[model samples]
Target: MSAVLAQAPAAEAVEDLAASLQEAGTVAAPPEDADAAIEEIGLREKESDQVIDKSDKKDPLYAISITSFEDPALELGELILKGLYEMKFSRPSKIQAASLPKIKMGRNLLAQAHNGTGKTCCFVLGMLRIVTPDTTPQALCICPTRELAKQIEEEVLKMGKYLILHKGIKVKCILRDERWERGERITEQIVIGTPGKIVSLLNMKVLDGGSIRMFVLDEADEMLNLGGLGDQSKRIRQRLRKDVQTLFFSATYTDAVKRLATQLSMDNPWSQIEVKREHIFNDQVAQYFYRTNGVTEKLERLTEILSVVNVGQCIIFVHLRDTVEQLANTLTANGHPVSPLHGRMEAGARDKVLVDFRNGTTRFLVTTNVLSRGIDVPAVTLVINYDMPVRKGGTADPDTYLHRVGRTGRFGRKGSALNMIHDEKEMVVLKQIEAYFDRQGLIKEIPPDTDGEEFEKILNVQ
Candidate 1:
């Protein structure tokens, strides 16, 4: 996780940050509508639609190298800058620097950046900037899962805390099993949820789509490709106002995905800032892979690593729900406390597991891809891919692997990624991923001959 979205700053840190900003004289006086923070938004967009809808041909890598919070390109207001200062955001991330200018211009953006690169904050800032704090749904964000939706909702609330305290600003998250029934009003300034739930709400007329000024698709590739979410997402977006700014963000972008996203942008043409796949892996994570004989050998190797390595916290990723059950049961029976999360589990059960993991009460979490992309847990010093991510056709899944390894390296802290590979076939896939990332030199092989001293040094925190 990146420092930008890993966790909320401590209360004392927040105060210290505020003091530092005040001393620097960058903090502005409270707005005249201090009670509301922001006035009600007008019905139409304030920017010219035609100019923003054009595609951007700038170098994607160069586009994201911005380091200033008050970059003139973003065109953020003084009050928004003040709120950002209070959040202790010392600088804009590379992705933020690249996309904020397009965002401020009201462009229909399709951006590709690695996980934890402040993608969530980039869109949250855009949403907060456009929202008028009125009772209508000015902005809507769609995620692939409930946990991710909640994560986005949490960040939005934290970023907008000042507005809540001063102007009574409201943002709502529609999670699993929650519904906005017909005849009931949805009067939040911002709404976030899974695509299905949002579409259902729209069909029931619970949400006034015409009033939504911004539409954002987080994890755009997954929301548009997996399951039947593409149709549902399209339905939800089709209902929004014509000139609404449409945005997409994901870690990977295929040619098909780019074309689909462009088509989805509809009346507004599309633009993108794409980082090469080989360059997305976080340098903070020290990656390693161990070769084994088979499934039994892989588990044995994992158990050995767990027993030998000193980790602040750990997560083990499997590919199937049943594997999660078997591995969790086996580990617990072996006297290692752990938790399991998967798609089939009830929402309440998943929530409890995540809460425990995030609080550091549960040090180890075993799961499928459910927690791969967006959920952030504290103190995760190790991430083990017990079973490598691959598609049903046995093809490499670089995107899934990237997100899984991203679970560690929290808040710019150094961490370890251990890939457990069994057999030549799996080894080939591992090499493919290594080649895909151009990380042959960065990722090392963990030979069995290594003494405990060498292994311990590998896991040692800097």
Candidate 2:
């Protein structure tokens, strides 16, 4: 039967070729062969040209040539120029370059860029241009988390150090736990704080909205995700005048966030910008993965990693508060310097942990996603995902995965991300993540006793 099948295929092929030659009045080729002949004669050359032109026109910057900081069109006050020089900002990032010009024109802006691309500076600079020393809360910047609010305040202060805004124009941080006094009006030119705090102050008539000429929302997507919509953001907006120039900035924007931003800005034409790089993973980061089961295996693998990797500063991400404390204790007992941070911790305790980490007193900080977004530590060289984040259908989003890895890489420095997955189900998720990033399998099995000098040599660990 196999011989007959093979011989029948040859006979059929001969008949088919003869039939093709007779039909064409010449030797006819397959459909694909005809297509190749047409293409070889340049029949589709005009179509290829049209495709190239379409692509070029679709590019965001096709007609827009970004101006350098020294461009004649770029204008700045003397105080602002001094502040920029003091902050040591030599050049503007892509977002900064694109948005600053429009912002200087006092246009409402909605911008999207990757983390660490300097979106914070773009809005800050824009606010500085609009805010005067006598202006009362002329610019208001709201962030999702208190940590982010505090960080933004610090950056604003640093960038405006040479200016007299700190003394002439007050900048207050409205924390959630703090209550607004009766006469404690927002007399500052710039106010930076969390949405909850700002909303509370506006509700209590402590934050005057009449003078708010410019509004900035940092991490706009996160603020909406945290449920900062309802009365707080709405009431705050109600107090602002109709002419207020609004700006929304975020690392990533979902459909919901975009809708919220559009409503806030009265459907202004938003500007979208992105900085393309070859790889999202930082080159300075030396990424590695290990397979482990349960808490004991996790601790063992972490111990092995810390013992070998020369990590000057590290952040360990955990899914739960209990795991954070437990890992901190275990690492401390194992002679590793570590600290714990979580949402459940008191505000003072969290502040102290951050201070210690910044001062080099704490070498390792284990926390949840609270430190993932706005917390910036330039020295963080190692980031370890001790436990995979629980997601819908036992799967996590790729954006969340990227944010977790983003903590370590900052200010053009190298960073590493180490993921731990033990079971086949988790391995399946890991494979999906690899496919999302267009990468091959990232998870590897570390053999037992893989901690010797030979292992170090294999990994090129010094």
Candidate 3:
């Protein structure tokens, strides 16, 4: 394992670094154009991020601001720009413009921003730019779930279309139950997979790490703090070349996970763009709650809400896989065609479900927190928390709540989040989340027995 991963503790290291930087009087400054750029992009004021660059600068990026993908500072290739235009991305998003340049500078980075902020493109473009047209893997990205891994691979293929066709660059998505020849080596130029699978491949000599120049961890906080994943991720990084440019991107991070991220940077002079609690909530998402008597009543209310409210796409969050199954059957019997997604489902089934949902074949998706973090679907206009999110110790998981609500209101689109509160525990969780965001009355309760018309009016649905 790498020394940083196995080091005593990161608390002291982070504190020491803070003290040294304070004494040296070198603190991070907000980019002059960041606020103006946010306004230009129509990003909500709460969505702005603060960047901290302690990297050994080849060139300073704080003073640098990119207006478009064609900016000289970004140095995006002609083919890549073509791909961007084909994808309908006319200009750089807030996160993309800010982080792409630092990535181009080849500095190790830890970036935090809200969901739907285009963090995927920042690292995908970086990998696509750095990777040579080769037979061996040149870039590796590890995500927490198979769904997220597949999503990243799709982006790679979409952005690297020209590279794949003209330059013969290949991309691969590695997941469980995907077979590899007994002694064959991975020939893909870019590999994206889960931590355990990637670690296993590295140990078995199936995936070569010597040529990997850029490493990325999406939903990095979960990658570093979840059970067994932290160690597995470390082992994979330990096997990579010492000079690899590492990047960690997540919507939220605990203090402990933030320290772990700093340690993972190793000897590299790292940079970070972190988002505070105040910056995670989207003003475009109107939040509301419904009080029910019990689980049965919660189910009744959810079905009632779906019957009347007109939603383009919706996600219903539950707490357990059994709930997913139960609700899927119940809702279907109640005349709603809903899709359920969870870790226990087969990979093929999950993929088909997500594809159907994204393409408008399915209008409602019921699942746990698996799709809460990095999955983005712009058409989703409503999110129903059938069961309020709670940590294992029965505390409110405010971060998860933020991510779940973030699924809607994506990219400045108007959306709504309706929380179903039944018991005292659920109410407590809701209150804690409200306090976490420091907005005591932000989440208002729907009028008792609100009709579908009244619901639409309150949420300002178009």
Candidate 4:
């Protein structure tokens, strides 16, 4: 390690870098236009034409499949193979085919794959194989949100059920519901949770890292960004052993995330698998936009769109907690069954709201960027960005916009994303998002409130 890094932890290193730059007055101002903003930040658009499709043999990655379930590469036992059969996962998806081998070899991974592509299964299998009964937390899987943490925990339990029942192994969810006694050890061989809870356990000595050998970060792009969860995750990793194997999985990437990956996986124990932006966003969803005057007109346009669009299950993403509640209440008063979700909601209430949305009891969910990544609601058909995301200093949030739209069009199903632009400023942000998606007419500009036959003919609105 460098002397500076050794003296200061990763979190402090970031702060120190910022402080030093600010002190020198070298922090450049951001570009006014979103396209220029992306370039100013050193992020260039991905050049490609083909889109992502797991079932398409024409997909270049389709050639990369595993031949033998009995291969020693994965070293799957008979019981695990039988369990896989029971789950009806006849073949590994694109990401799984490419990632499983590298993971089993213990190489650190930086993978970018959309949801419903079986990426979780790849890490789950690796965790199952790596975990041993040394009576300590041997594996740690950290996610961005409690909802995603629970989702991953559910998959881990399902895939590793045989081990859980036969070998007396355990997979624990480290959310608020899990209670711990003072001075007690977390003996689970595999652990999964959000960042703060995991860090708190380490601090309290309740979850020792001495036995942790494998660290998996789901939605790693989000976890490694400049945010609270990212900070906590870095501190948590700093506490682990040097040789610990790390795996990063996400649906997208930016220059910052790529730089972080190279820095963390610097020992040459690393492998990267990234798809072109076009290849990831094409064909799955039809993107469209409608311009509004501002927030006042936005409410009217949103109501018009909702009344027109045939929403099977929809998620409308905004940029604030107050907006979520406001929109949810407004739509509810108009007789729509909508639920609001944000970071501040209580744990039980959050779980209940998500459950209701997932089970189709509530057909609409209004939320913040909190629901942007690692959220898999396969039934959703419509995603409306009520407000495009911007960085703290008003730079474009293209990565987040991609995640917001990815909520739909899962598993090769055709879905749709509608971006709401208020003015020239937001139009700039939308352009950056468009360029990130390869700008070849993927997103269409639909006039606001075009109704009746025109709505059906153009947008297939309900």
Model 3, span 105-224: residue lDDT tens: 666888887776678888999888877766888889999889889889988899888888887889989998887665889998899999999988887889998878889999898899
* Pairs in steric clash, model 2: 284-414, 284-415, 285-415
User: Once model 3 is optimally superposed onto the true structure by TM-score, how far is the C-alpha of residue 416 displaced, in angstroms?
Assistant: 0.5
Q: Which pairs clash in the backbone of model 4?
A: 52-279
How accurate locally is residue 79 in candidate 1, as Cα lDDT from 0 to 100?
62
Off by over 4 Å in 3: 1-59
In model 4, where is the ten-residue run with the lowest total lDDT?
1-10
Best by the lDDT measure = 3
How much is 200 displaced in model 3, in angstroms? 1.5
lDDT of 4: 0.72
TM-scores of the candidates in the order shown? 0.84, 0.79, 0.87, 0.83
User: Model 1, 1-462: lDDT tens per residue?
Assistant: 112111233445434433443344222333433212211210111112111112444422223333455654444556667676555565555567567755755668898777666678789999887776568888899988899999899888888777666666689999867745579979988999998888888888888898887899998888788458888888987898777788998877667777888887775644577666666776667898888888897786676666677788899999999999999988888767779999999999999999888888887899999889877764888998888899888878877898898887756567789888888877887887887787776668889676666777876642
TM-score leader: 3
| Count of clashes, each model | 2, 3, 0, 1
Question: Weakest 10 consecutive residues, lDDT, candidate 1?
Answer: 38-47
Model 1, global lDDT: 0.73
Better by lDDT, candidate 3 or 2? 3
RMSD of each: 10.3, 19.0, 6.9, 13.0
Q: Residue by residue across 422-462, what tens digits does model 4's lDDT show?
A: 88988888887767677656679987657645644565423
Would you give me the overall lDDT of model 2?
A: 0.64
Q: What's the lDDT for all of these models?
A: 0.73, 0.64, 0.79, 0.72
